[model samples]
Target: MNYMDDFPMLNKDIVYFDNGATTLKPKSVIKAMDDYYLNYSSNAHRGDYKISLKVNDAYEGVREKVKKLINAKSSNEIVFTSGSTDSLNMIVYGYFKNKLNKDDEVLVTKSEHASNILPWYELSNEMGININYIPLTENHTVTLDNVIKSITPKTKVISIAHVTNVIGDVRPIKEIIEYAHKNNILVVIDGAQSVGHIKVDVQDMDIDFLAFSAHKMLGPTGVGVLYGKYDLLNELIPTRYGGGMNISFTSKDEIEYKELPYKLEAGTQNIAGVIGLGAAIDYINNVGINNIEETCDSLKEYIISGLKSIPHIKVYNENVEGSIVTFNVKDVFAQDTAIYLDKYNICVRSGSHCAKKLEDELGIKNTCRISIYFYNTKEDADKLINALKNENILEESLGV
Candidate 1:
């Protein structure tokens, strides 16, 4: 099936491969969000009228969609946030600040995105919790053996990406989560890269907390889901407080909060974005995630083979299962190479990709990344490969 028809932005002249940064929104998603503004646009849970009720129901309904998407136990476990960064911060400040002691250790990896790393770094600085990195394998994927070896008595939590944004290797999170639970260590997964591309069952994996952005999965920006176990979510101190989240303000000091998710989702939310997310989910479901995965896997294999034939291109990842390809052109700066590719109307990501610490692990300062989605075709891959095959194109494009 040609998905290019669904995304109006895709064309023969434009080969977009920067899906790891963000995905192009489908027309259905756009229309869903637009429908809200065109017909009924109101603050949810604040009004009693028909339009208000419609808004409220649509907003709350997305929670159910999200609950089903990740196979969460209940809708009460899904809390809407601005994005994965906001969700991770909420986990740190709301839960960890109160639960962890001064000497407690939280294990993370150098390959994690900044959203997953910085929150723990700040928490460590303020609360005196120790920040530890679980050693990564040579291919940059986390292993069960390393996680077991890294755990100490004080290790209270392990935060990692389900798929490293830079390396695109799917981490062995299910095994790690099972082991962490046995040792009483909470596991938090950053699913920004893995969620829409791969099937994730939070309950099946026994994941303690999972955070992901909707935009990365063909949904609207400024909207994301933070899934937590109901018991654990209730234990967290609500990070934000406002009108919608509280039940009563009897006195200046005495205020009663609502329930599990409302307490976390303070103030007005991205109602239209949430609705668009529901539509995006529908589009994904219709297309079938299994098919998407198979398509991307084949495309990745084809791209890797093509890149291997190019002598100047150095592919960074090995045994990579996902659709992302990170590499650098020999003697050419990553940004310059990306700019040269841009001259051919091929879009790709360059630089550290918000995983700055990964540079030391990969032994490089920056790389050019090609992140493919289902919309991308083998023809698109050929365009990129043929562009790189021209050895003098980089310098020619630079006018050097």
Candidate 2:
């Protein structure tokens, strides 16, 4: 598929390998948002006019699309939020905070993004719960053995990323979820990196809670989804309160809150972002998620092989499978390598990548990450390889 025509940014003179941060927006998603603003710019559930009615339909319609995207049980299972960070915060503070007692443990990994870790950290401090780590294998990948070993009698919840943003290793989520269920533990999956690149079926996995951002999957920013089972999700207290989430309220302690998702979402909401997310789902369905994953895997293998052939290039996570390749130019700082690559019109991410503790596992604090999407071609790989092959990379990066 010719994705260059669809993504406006691709036509520019640059190779983007930062999909883990966010994917490029497709034209269809942009057009949908534009149409929403130009045609029906009305607040949802607040008016009975024609455009407002249309806004409600488009807004709620995206909920159904999200439900089908993840094979969720019902549309009510999806609650829109600001982003994956907001969704995870809701899961941690809104639900788990009230459920866990003092000294209860929640399992997470070092490779998890900060959004997944920090919320749990705050919850642990407030509730006196222990935050535990699921040991990663020598390859920095989680195994069922490690998960089993990490779970103790006090372990009430297992919170982890379906795919680690730092290493891009796809965790054995199904096996882990199955084992956790057997031990009567609820699982919270951070699907920010996985949902956009791979197939995720909440029903098949029996996931307790799932969170992901639309921007990472070719949709606009400021829109995300928090998916939970109907019964468990309803148990979550509304972290925020306002209009559109209640039916009636009075000074005499007479307040009736809405149910399920509406109870969780209590504001004007991001109407344009929601419509764009629906369009993004439509685009993904047309291209096929499996096809996108396969393309990324093939490209990743090729890129890794090319980088490995360069003597000065040290590739990390080379054995790990996924759309990301982490490496460093020997004797050059990670950010310096990123700056040098920018000289060649290539884009890559550097630094700790929001997984600060991953340094304990890697024994290195920083590495350049190349997170690919389906749109990236082998030519992008060639450009990056050639740039690494050039002489005086250290001096050039140092501006000497």
Question: Could you say which candidate leads in lDDT?
Answer: 2
Tens digit of lDDT per residue, candidate 2, span 1-400?
5798999999999999999999999999999999999999999988879999999999999999999999998999999999899999999989998899999999999998999999989888887999999989999999999999999999999999999988999998999999999999999999999996899999998999999999999999999999999999999999999988988889659989998889999978999999999999999998999999999999999999998889998888999999999999888999999998988889999999999989999999999999999899999989988898976887888755
Local distance difference test values of all predictions, in order: 0.92, 0.93
Question: Where does candidate 2 clash, by residue pair?
Answer: none
- TM-scores of the models, in the given order? 0.98, 0.99
> How many backbone clashes are present in model 2?
0
Global lDDT of model 1? 0.92
Question: Per-residue CA lDDT of candidate 1, range 1-400, in tens?
Answer: 4677789788557999999999998999999999999999888998889999999999999999999989999999999999899999999899989999999999999999999999999999898999999988888888899999999999999999998889999988899999999999999999999889999999999999899999999999999999999999998898888878999998989989999899998888889999999999999898888988998889999999999999988999848788899999899999989999998899999999999899879999799999988988899999999999989856766856
